[model samples]
Target chain A: MQHTISVLVKNEAGALSRMTNLFSARGYNIESLTVSTTLDTKYARATIVVTHCDDSVIEQILKQLHKLIPVIKVCDLTPENSTTLELVFIKVDSKNEVGELLKIAEAFGVKVIDVSPKTYTLQAVCNEKQLKSLVELLRPIGIKDIVRSGAVSINVKSE
Target chain B: MTNKIITKELTGSQVFLECLKNEGVDTIFGYPGGVILGIYEAFYHEKKIKHYLVRHEQAAIHAAEGYARVTGKCGVAIVTSGPGATNTITGIANAYLDGHPLVVFTGQVSASLIGNDAFQEADIVGITRSCSKHNYLVKDIKDLARVIKEAFYIANTGKKGPVVIDLAKNVLDAKIEFEYPKEVDLEGYNPTYKGNPKQISKALQLLCNAKRPAIISGGGVLSSEASEELTELAKLLNVPVATTLMGIGTYPMNDQMALGMLGMHGNYWANYAISNCDVLFSIGTRFNDRITGPSKEFAKNAQIIHIDIDPCSISKNVTANIPIVGDAKIVLQAMLEEFKAKNYEINKENKREWFEQIEEWKKQRVIPEIQSEKLHVHTVLEQIYEYTKEYEPIVATEVGQHQMWTAQAFNFTKPRKLLTSGGLGTMGFGFPAAMGACLADKNRLVLNIAGDGSIQMNIQELATCVEYNLPVKVMIMNNGYLGMVRQWQEKLFDRHYSETKISGPDFVKVAEAYGAKGIRIKKKEEIIPALKEAIEYQGPVFLDFIVEPFEMVYPWVLAGTPIDKVILSRKE
Candidate 1:
């Protein structure tokens, strides 16, 4: 099962590498990772979305993470009933299929964030599956560029 | 009187020097670089502190580890940021895994340009976080003195491991009031120092009752410098002693009851003893997979009594019937007293017969028969052992068949003398670690028995040895293949050799290239003479012995197999 993990770590050098090493060493695939400074100046919050691992494996990973001196805590945000979204910006050729692209964008509730003479940048805020479908549909019309922000998640209820 | 005032503007380099001196650090190993020029300027004038310019930052870290391992003191290293810091990653990890105390200082870009992607600003603290027990980033100049003191204390205390302090260029330049904190207040860093007396008494009772009892010692005993206590306990209990690869030198290898190494590549007698014993007492060792074979089948009939310094390591791998968590030195000392108080007598019912059986097994399987004209790995170990028989020199080795051979062949009667990277199994650990060990004990001869692949990993340390004029003998078992991996492939993969064969430059030439005396020996008769010549050489000397590639160390127990089910050489 795919699970979203939130890790609170000391804000220090090589922290990211350490996290990546932990995952890679155990043969765990990191589907997406987002890091930012937390409310505390001395700590950083990392939200990592991983896939196809059982609850026991996820618990093992968290236990291993706790073993690291810098890691303060690790939380599985999936169980907390949280809000999550993945951001993607894709540019497509708009000269020939402007109406068709606009219709598809309206159907998915995506916004045209940027526009050039021959390109239209569509911005979408959705889950990973929806993002994948959007990319697949736009591939027929020719996608000039695609940039994904992976995934960022937060719990709806405060701790 | 009111107008009298003094002013001095000191750079970060001056602060670094003052901070080190304040922390009572006597020596440091580092190499100067473009980013570390300011620190070098301060180092130039610091006559009170001795600094050795190592060939590489990695060697510098290992050198520190050597100094720390022997003296039980904090080893210190200084390096420039970016690649310089990154180069020491493996050494740091090795020390971290082995639980050695080390303090590393790296030069970072000035505070203003830290995130600007400036030259030599590679986020060293971030790079070393996973490898280090703890790390600090000196953002303010005022924090330098306190941070340096804390780094040393933290690295040397509790569960000892490497700790890094990344100093910003500006922090080294900015001057502030200097004061060193005498104590550290860490809530999460408490190490267990006292073993439970009840548990110790129970373990002693078990030892007294079992006719066939064995003590399996590991590297933790060496780290705690408790070999004396361990030896005393084993003798009092009248039990045979076996060691893991990491625990090589804990008990005198020549001792009558000593069964060299126990595990996959361990001695047959040791494996037999472990399988037949009624009680197994493990001390200062983490029963690694290589040592235990199949966890479920290992010592199935024996009751396990585990004693360790780290609580987390007590039952982390193998379940212990009696878990005593504390410092090895303290626990062993306590056990000795308890044994004396109880006046325990050795059980003699089956003890004599068991010992005789073990000795027979050793006579039959421990002694290797090398019939080939080519120099075998066992032959090299025997030659080295013969040469160093009187001295019992500190022998360090890299990860390979050579490492196993050294562990089995060499009689390490003294604890903390056989220094090798066991938990990490680092390839390039020998040369540099030997250099460190030699530096730690100037009177003792340090021998680095390394494989061709493992030697090339840290061959650059020869320059450091030459610079220090340290006499460290480098014996290379040139099998021209990744011996261990190849052995596994040959036995398990039906001899389908993929990328195990090593095709590279000659090791003798490579050793000479590093400004060290080198000798190449192809004849079997020349092994002793070459070893003697290398040992006699004043400075560092490398002897490359071209060994047979397919010769596998025997009495092997495949992973997950019981010790009794070992596949002997004749079976192969």
Candidate 2:
């Protein structure tokens, strides 16, 4: 099972490394992680994606995150109770992707962020399923490069 | 000028000592170096604080850990930057894993030269980031007082672990107001002290309803000083009580209800009880892999109700049916109250069948027998226990076969009597810890049971002990090998001893070279006399007891094996 956990931590030096070091120290898996300063400036939010974890392991990860001194809060965010978004960018051969790629991008609700002579970059910010399917559609067009912002989330109940 | 706030200005070093004094700390275990000279200079006029300079930076922290274990006070250690700071990492990790309260200070390069890699500078805060409960890098003189206060508070409170404070050299020379923080206010830190009343009641209900309930205690109970509460609860309920190595001496091993310890290398009956009991009520133990052989197979028939101070530890290894996050002492008190409300009584008939079953398993329990005419580790431990039991001595152990033998053979009736590194299993911890233990309480006897392979790790501490006049008695079981590793290779690796065989300097000569008493005992008849002389000696003494080289710790359960599935079938 894959679980997404968000940790709110005090904005300080080595705060993110604490999270990474903790995962490594406890032998916990981290598939993807994205960290950035929050709007509050004093705090930062880290979204960590862990795979092949049981419910008990996820519970421990959350509890251990809370144990970090700089951590203000930690929550396990599931797709059902939270709104998640991952911004992905995929670049492909512009000449070959000029016509059908735009059509496929339109169908998948992705934006053509850059269209240069050599490459065209497609962008999408959606939940995991939509992002995966969109990336698959672009793969046949000969992808040149790819980048993902991992996953960010907001608890719906909090709103 | 009318709205101005004024405070007395003092140098950074003055504030440093003042903060420790304000925190009620009078002793410092540390060493001096170029980067830490400012703080060392302040010690010249320091009347309240006494500093014990150790031979190595690592020994300083271990000594502090030993001090903390005995006194229930946060251990304080200070060391210089770079190599000096790096040396203490092992001790810091040991304290972190064992949950000892230690506040370690490491001097760093000037704040401006922090990332520039200046001479003798290391990012110790980042180095100890994961191992320490919390850490701080004092970039400004103004933040010094509050950081020190918070370091002390964080180390001593909640789960009780090490905290590191990396100080820049320039900051120590800078001027700051000498007002120590009156209180620590960490926004992200608040520990749960009182257990939920509903959860306590529910757990008590489960205990009352179960016919075969047992209590497994761990270091958290020792940390919380909840032995009295745990004793009462176990006695009143007439439930069998087993302890983890960290919880040894918390519940008297000789108690009829006491099943000794339960885990790898634990009591056979105790492990059997843990395997078969229906209601497993664990207090203060984290259920680490050492205690629970295979998480899935451990206590398969039991519904575990775990009470721990750290929430992260509750279900980290094994799932807890009822998890209560609070101080052990507080939760035990609440459980006691809940037990009273439920009119709990000692109804022996209800658990008569369970008791009979445990007794049956107890019949298979293994004891250390005099296998050969050669001196045995158990015999030495038993004789030492007999001689030292009257003083209520504190026993520290270097990790090896001797450590396990001491853990199983010695009977400790009080919490904090045994100070071995349970989680980290550190080898060199025993001697320095014994030194720290003696300094913590000068009157009580302090003993370090060591192995030939382990005693050499921190043998340099003999100088520190002799200089300070700390009468720390070190009994090295001279087995001529790393007994634990040798046992593993002998059993699992086709009787291939490999590199487990090791030789060391003559410990008695080494002790005497460091100006401490040294005694060598080769015959069984000399054990009593040597121990008496060492105990009577006014300074540090090292007793090298030559013992059988092939003895192994029994009742050992292989990792991932069921606790009841004892391999090797000792003395069958």
Candidate 3:
């Protein structure tokens, strides 16, 4: 099972290390983690995606995270109850399928952010499913490079 | 516009002592080094806080832990950087796991030199983060006083544990206007001390409905000063009471409802009650594997109601039907209030049946017997218990079989009387902790019951005890092996022994060299007189009792087995 946990921490040196230590120290598998300063510059929010964990373990990890002095809040986000987004940049060899790739990007409402003689770089920001589909659709076009911003979420019920 | 501003100036080291005073700290256990020289200089000028210079930084922390455990007050320790800071790691981990309140101040390299790997410098904050309840590395001089205040507050409140504050050398040298924060507002650290009304009601309902109820009180009860409440509740509800090793003194051992201890090497009756109970009321215990045996099988027939101060500990191991996150004393009081409000009373006849069953289990329980004419370990503990029974002495122990023997044989009738490494089970905790206990109260006798292997772990602390003139009587059960590990190897590993076989310097000679009284007893007949002599005239006395080398703690439950599946005797 996978869980997307949102953590709010004080903006300080080693704050991220303290939060990540809670996972690494316990051998919890963290699939993706994205951290950025919140609107309040004094605080930062980190969205951590963990895989291959059970409900009990996830619950404990949340509790341990709460114990960290730098951490202010921890929210376990679910797909139904929370809004989430992941942004990805995909570069495909467009010499062979320039028309096909552009058409596919237009269909998904993605922009061709960059284009070279042999490749086209497309940018998309959406839910994980739509992002995965875009990557799958472009695989036949020969992906030259792909980079993703890890999942970030906010609970619908709380600020 | 003539406006005059007043500023008070003081060095960071002076602020350190001032903040400690504000926290009501009267004593500190610490060792001085190059990086901590500034604090030592400030200490010389400020004589308000008495400092006990321990021989080793580790002993300083253990002594502080002992002091904290005895007084229910936060213990304070100070050590210099690098090796000095790392030396306290075991003691910090022990206190952290056992929920002892300790605040440790470690000197660090100047801020500029921290990352340069400067001489005698180590990242104390980074090193201690995982072991500490909370830690701070004070970079700015202005944050020094507030961080110290927060360290003490966090260390002593809620689910108490050790907190480390790493002070850079430059910060100690820098002068700042010191204003101690009256209160700390940590957004993430608010702890709920009161039980939820609904949860209390539910727990009370379970208690009223239970036909076979058992209360397992743990270290939380001791730490929270809830023994009276726990005892009253158990008696009021006609529930049999058992204690974890850490909870030894939480209830009177002589009480009819009391079952001495529960878990691996716990009393047979207590283990039986746990396995058969209709409702298991656990207070202040983490349900560690040693107590639960096999987590899945533990109290499978019972509804377990776990009340802990730390929310994370509630269901980390075993699931709790009713999880109450609150201080043990507060929660127990709430439950008692709810019971009275609802006019709930125990059905005497129904409870009588349960008591009778526990009695039956007690009758069938195996009490280890000394089959040899030679002196045995239990006999030594029994004699010590008999000698010290009148004084109600504070007992501390190093980890191993002697610790278990002391737990089994010694009578701890009140809370905070017994101090041992219950969680981390760190070796060499007993002697220094006993010194700390003695330091806290000079009137009461302090005893350190140690194994040959464990006593040697921090034997250097004997000098500290002698220097402080603390009357800590150390009784070493000379088993010549790490008795607990050897017992396991004997049972499961074909008795290969391996590195379990260990030797120690003659403790009597060692004590004499440290300018402490020394006594050696090789026969059972000499035990009582030696104990009396040592207890009567002792700055510090190290008594070596050479007992049976192969004695094992019985009623042993193998790892991952149910608590009920205890091996009754060696033959069994």
lDDT of each: 0.82, 0.90, 0.90
User: What are the per-residue Cα lDDT tens digits for candidate 2 across A26-123?
Assistant: 89999889999999999999999999888878888888888888899998998789988889888888877478888988887889988888999888
Residue by residue across B1-572, what tens digits does model 2's lDDT show?
58778777889989999999999998899999988899999998899999999999999999999999999999999999999999999999999999999999999998988889888888788888878898999989999999999999999999999999999988899997688778887888999999998889878888877899999999999999999999999887788999999999889898989999888898888998999999999998888899898889999999899999899888888888999999999999988887887776556788999999988888875656566778999888889999889998999999988998899888888899898999999999999999899989989999999999888899899889888899999999998999999888877798899998899888888887899989999888999999999988898999999899887788888767888887435454
In candidate 3, what are the lDDT values of residues A40-145, reduced to their tens digit?
9999999999999898999899998987878899989998889898888988998897888888989999998988898888899887889878888899989989
Report the poorest 10 consecutive residues by lDDT, candidate 3 chain B.
B364-373
User: Model 3, A19: alpha-carbon shift in Å?
Assistant: 1.2
Candidate 1's docking class is: incorrect
Model 3 whole-model lDDT (C-alpha atoms): 0.90
Clashing residue pairs, candidate 3? none
Report the C-alpha lDDT of model 3 over B426-504, residue by residue, as the tens digit.
Answer: 9989888998899787799999999899988999888888887998999888878889999999999999899999988
Sort order, DockQ high to low: 2, 3, 1
Instruction: Estimate the lDDT of model 1.
Output: 0.82
Instruction: Please tell me which predicted candidate would have the highest TM-score against the true structure.
Output: 3
Pairing residues by index, what is the TM-score of model 3? 0.98
Q: Candidate 1 residues B1-572, lDDT tens each?
A: 67755546567678778767777778788987766788998887889888887888888888788777767788889999888988889889989888899999888888888888998779777777667888888889877777777788778765688999988877866776555567765533456788999999999888888977888988888778888898888887788899888777778887887888888888778888898889999998777888887777788889999988765566666778999988889989998887777777767765887777777887757446565778888877887899887776888888888888887788777766777787788888877778778767888888889898998887777778887887888888888899999988988899988899986577777767877888999887888788778878888888888888888877688877877766668345
CAPRI grade, predicted model 3: medium
